[model samples]
Every structure is written in C-alpha cells, then in structure tokens.
Target: MSNDDGSMKELVEFVAKALVDEVDRIEISEITGNQTNIIELKVAKEDIGKVIGRQGRTADAIRTILNCAAAKLNRRYILQIIDE
Candidate 1:
C-alpha cells in the first residue's frame, strides 16, 4: 500500500470510530485491487444502524468523502458497511 492508502484507511477509520458507541469494536479492512479499492467497515452489532443512519445517508456521506479523496489520487474507492 502507498502513503495515500494509509491516509485513506485512516480517514475511514476515524469517521467510523466517531459513529460507533463501542469505538474499540470498530474494524476497517482495505482490500486493494488493480483498479479499485474496497473498504470494509465493521462496527458493533448494536451500532450498525447508527453508522448506516436513516436511509443509509450517513454511509453515503462517508462514501462520498472517500470517493472525493480517491479522485484526487486517481483511484476508485468502494465502501461496504457490515455488522460485527
């Protein structure tokens, strides 16, 4: 992974941690590909709705920020929110 990857991961992690009641239960995994990157966000089961928000708007906002950042780096990003 490059420095940009690290920063992007940190960005997702930072945002996810802030949305969860159990910050310690939050986990993010990055799967790097040739053309696109997949960021998997996992938070406590009880906090899933909070992260996903009403009508998934919160998740969409996070994804929007990620895509904007990825565009500057000439990359593509995909966010997947999961319960853990």
Candidate 2:
C-alpha cells in the first residue's frame, strides 16, 4: 500500500477508536483497488450502536469526512462498519 493508503486506514482507525468504548476491540482493514478502496471497520458488539449513532448520522458523518479526504487523494473510499 502507498503512504496515502496507510494514512486513510489510520484516519478511520483514529475516528473509530474515539467513538467506541472498547478502543482495543476496534479493528480496521483496508482493501485497495485500482479505482476504489474499502475500509472495513469492526468494533465490539456492545459498542456498535455508539459508532453508528441514531439514524446512522454518525456513520454518515464519518463517511463524509473520508470521502472528502479521498477526493484530495484522487481516490474513492468506502467505509463499512462491521459489527462483530
């Protein structure tokens, strides 16, 4: 992965860790493709609600930020919040 790719991963990790109570339980995986990147975020089952927030607004906000950042890098980022 390129430095920009790693930075995007870290960006998701940092935000996810802050929202979930179990910071250590948060896991982020990145799948880089030619045109788009997928960021899979897993958090503790109990903390899933916290990360998602009501009406999914929180998640949407995170995606919005990610989209803006990815645009600057000329990439597309898809954030998938996985509960496990």
Candidate 3:
C-alpha cells in the first residue's frame, strides 16, 4: 500500500513472483489503513504450495519481511495470502 513515500505493491509483487512458478498468473493488491497496510497475494492454484510452504512458514516469512521493511520506514504493513 502507499506509505506516504511510495507504494508497497512492488514488494508484494516481488514476493508473489518469487514464490510462484507461473509468475504471469500472480496478482498482488494493496489495502491501507491508519493502523497497517495490507498486501493481498494471489497465485496460480498449483503454486499456492510454494508460497505457503510447509506449515505456512514461508507465508510467515513473507509477512515478516513486510513488517521489517515497514518498520524501517516507520510504517506498518501486512501480507494477506489468498487464492482466486
């Protein structure tokens, strides 16, 4: 989401593309609020596993990265992984 300086959608796209084999099918959306920025990630059905990883560790890692970056900018962000 837009965090005053710039949009965090780029980060979402990068993460989604990295996680999916079918990069062309990946989609990322941003939702921002006073509290936090939400990044929704959608990928090809077959590649969902790659994004989520075993026990959702990979997904958590993505969120962690988002949070870390946001913290550096003195902003807040969240990554919401979805399938569509």
Clashing pairs in 3: none
Summarize candidate 2's per-residue lDDT along 9-84 as a digit string, tens digits: 9998989988888998988999888898999999999999998899999999999999999999999999999998
In candidate 3, clashing pairs total 0
* Cand. 2 TM to true fold: 0.96
Candidate 2: Cα lDDT at 76: 97
Residues 38-60, candidate 3, lDDT per residue (tens digit)? 77888888998999999999988
Off by over 4 Å in 3: 1-7
The list of candidate 2 runs beyond 4 A from truth reads none
- Which residue pairs of candidate 2 clash? none
TM-scores, each model vs. reference: 0.96, 0.96, 0.85
Q: Of models 2 and 3, which has the larger TM-score?
A: 2
lDDT to native, each model: 0.92, 0.92, 0.78
Pairs with steric clashes in candidate 1: none
TM-score of 1: 0.96
lDDT of 3: 0.78
lDDT of 1 by residue, 1-84 (tens): 879888888999999888888999988899999999999988999999999999999999999999999999999999999997
